[model samples]
Target: MRLSLISSIRRPGFRVRPLLGFWHRWFGLFAALWLALMAITGSAVVYYEELGSWLNPDLRQVEVINPALPPETWLGAAKAEYP
Candidate 1:
């Protein structure tokens, strides 16, 4: 006698509630995972600058300068790099 898995699953007394329950559990897990991912990314976007500063401890503070650099000087440097 050969035992077939399909035959057992197709038995007339087998109930579908268990299969539905299994799928329901899986769907709930996926939905929760997707929501969690979205929430994490959304929070990161909302706190982008804060997150960057937190990640880079060194950049959180700068040495005090008596005089700030001129805007023209900053613009020149940016143009030099980008152009």
Candidate 2:
């Protein structure tokens, strides 16, 4: 079966050439457009974080405070605030 398939491909006839040509033309025609779209989407995904930070600079640039304060401090703060 493999031999027959390979032989048929190698033989090259009107049928195979036209079929291959049609597929080649169609795929080639769409390849550039598909690649451009893929490139744009890929770049967007890669720079998503940077883009988000650019849009919301304040939120992204805020300082991160240490939350390792003593338990007593937390309890006192919570009680003072809630009570």
Candidate 3:
């Protein structure tokens, strides 16, 4: 028996709507994942210094001197050297 065009065609019941719906669902899932990744990384960038300091408190700490000079005295010394 000879095959007709309609009979020879594969997936006779295939429709555009279902195919598009499948693609849409996957696209939305991937887009949501990418957005979440960007948001997390962006927050990390915004708080880079704080994150580093929190991770290494000893390295970020500064030593304090008891007898620190006043700002006026430092300014006078700087002006004398420059002028």
How much lDDT does each candidate structure score? 0.91, 0.87, 0.91
Total residue pair clashes for candidate 1: 0
lDDT of 1 by residue, 1-83 (tens): 24677776577977799989999999999999999999999999999999898899898888886778899999999999999
Candidate 2 global lDDT: 0.87
TM-score sort, best first: 3, 1, 2
Q: Deviation in angstroms for 32 in model 3?
A: 0.2
Clashing pairs in 2: none
Query: At residue 63, what lDDT does model 1 achieve?
Result: 84
Query: Which residues of candidate 2, in runs, are more than 4 Å off?
Result: 1-16, 58-83
TM-score, cand. 2 vs. native: 0.44
Better candidate number, 2 or 3, judged by lDDT: 3
Of the candidates numbered 1 and 2, which has the greater lDDT value? 1
> Given candidate 2, what's the lDDT at residue 42?
98
Report RMSD (Å) for each prediction in the order shown: 9.4, 8.0, 6.0
